[model samples]
Target: MASDAGVPDPETQSLDADELAFSDEGIEATLSPADPESDIAAIFDALFLISRLAQHNFPARIDIHTFAYLACLMSIYSGQPANEWGYSFSAVPPTLPYSPTLDGAIDRLVETDYLKTSKSTDVTNLAEFELTPEGERELGFFSTLSLLSRRLQFLDASTSAAVFTSSAAVVNSLANEPQLAAATHLNSSRQLLTESSTARLYDEFEALSQAIGKTDVNLILPASMYVSYLQSVMRATAEEATGEAVENA
Candidate 1:
C-alpha cells in the first residue's frame, strides 16, 4: 500500500527542515530588534562628563584619550556600577582602558560642533579637543534635564576642592587601577575586559559609601575613597608582580 500523497518522504522531510532552519526569513524571524536606548544613554553620559571636564580644564585642551579616562572616573564617582555604566573599555597599558564608546561620543560631538578640535592629526585620539561655546550651552541644557540632575550634582561635588584638588590627579589615577592592570595583563592574549573584573572595586566603593552615611556634602566622599582604594590596590599589585619576577629570576 502506498503512503498518502501529502506525506513527505524521510529525505524530503529532512530537506524541508534544513531549509526552514537555515533560510534568511527563518533566521530573521528568530532575532529581536536592537534596542538603542542603552547606546543613547551612554552617549549622553559621555557628553555630560566630557563637557564638564572640558569646562573644568577650559583654555587647556586635552586629548581624546584623556577625556575618556576622566569620564570613566566621573561615572564611577556618580555611583554607577561597572556593569551598569554606559561605557566599556579595553585594557590599554600606561593609561586607562581605551573606550570605543567614548571615542565614538567624541566623534559625534565634533561632527555636531559641540566640541572643537584644536589640532587635527592622523590619529583622532591624539588630537586635542575642548568644549565649544555651543557645547557649554548644550551642557546648560543638559543641567535642566530632570534625568541628569543627580549626575550634575555628583559632578559638582567631585569638582569641589573638598573632594579632590585637581581633575588631573583623577586622570593620573587611572594608570594605577589594579583592575585595569589585570585587564592589561590579559589583553596580550586578546581577551576582552569583563565587567566582573571591576566588581570588587565597585562593591568596596558601595560599602564605604554605606559606612560614611548619606548627606548632601557626603556625595563626594565615596569618590575620594574609591580613588584611595584604587591607589592602594595598585601598589599592592605592583609589589606582588615585582616579587614574583625577582623570585623567578
Candidate 2:
C-alpha cells in the first residue's frame, strides 16, 4: 500500500529505520564526514542526486531492489571517484548487492510522494514502485540546479539516451560487472563491496578518461564504454557456459 503525503506506511517506516541504521553504520565506517571539501563529501552529494535521477528517469515501474541496484550503477558512472563513495552492499544470492542507503532513499521518496507503490506480479512478492507525476515535477526543479544540470547533460551527451532508460540493459550491465564476478568467487554469503573494492573500477574509468583526452571528453563517455564492455563480457560468458554444457551433454 502507498502512503499518504508526508507519512509513510507502516512497512515503509520500519524499512526506513532499518535501512538508516545499516547505511549509517556501514557507510560511516568507510567514509569519514569530517572534511566538507573532501572527495568523500562530493561523492555523497553525487550519490544523492544520482539516485533521484535514476528514479525519475527509469522507464517503468521498479522494485526497491532494482531501483537500488541501478542507482549504485549510476553513481559509479556519474564520474565521481567511485572509491570515495562509501556505499556498502551485501551480496544477495542470485542478485546484485543490496544497498541500504539507496533502499532508504526509495522509502523517503515514497513518504514525500515522489514515488508510489504498485502491484507486484513476480514471485518475490516485493512491492514495486513508480515515480509519481509530482516526482517528475520535483526533478524539473532540481534540473534548475547547476550541479544536477551539468551531470544530466554529461550523461545525455556521453551515452545513448536509450541505454539509461532501458531496464534490461541496466540489469545486464550490473550483473556482468567484473566486481560482481570477484565477489562470487569469494564464496561469501555476506560479501561487502567496500571502497577499496571499487578501486579497480575507478582506475579503469580514469584510464579511459586520460586516453580520450580531457579537452572534449565527458565522463559519461568513459562510463558508457565501461558498461558496454561489461555487457559484451556477459554475452561471451553466457555463450561459453552454454557450449560447455552442450559438450558435457
Candidate 2 per-residue lDDT, tens place, 14-64, comes to 211112111112233443333322322233233334344444453222223
Best model number under lDDT:
1
Give the per-residue lDDT digits (tens) of candidate 1, residues 16-38.
21122211111112111122433
- Give each model's whole-structure lDDT: 0.49, 0.46
Highest TM-score against the true fold, candidate = 1
| Candidate 1 C-alpha error for residue 25, in Å | 32
Cα misplacement distance, residue 218 of candidate 1 (Å): 3.7
Query: In model 2, how large is the Cα lDDT of residue 195?
Result: 45
* Clash count for each candidate, listed in order shown: 0, 0
Question: Which 10 consecutive residues of model 2 have the lowest summed lDDT?
Answer: 15-24
Q: What is the alpha-carbon RMSD of candidate 1 to the true structure?
A: 15.9
TM-score of 2: 0.59
lDDT computed for candidate 2: 0.46
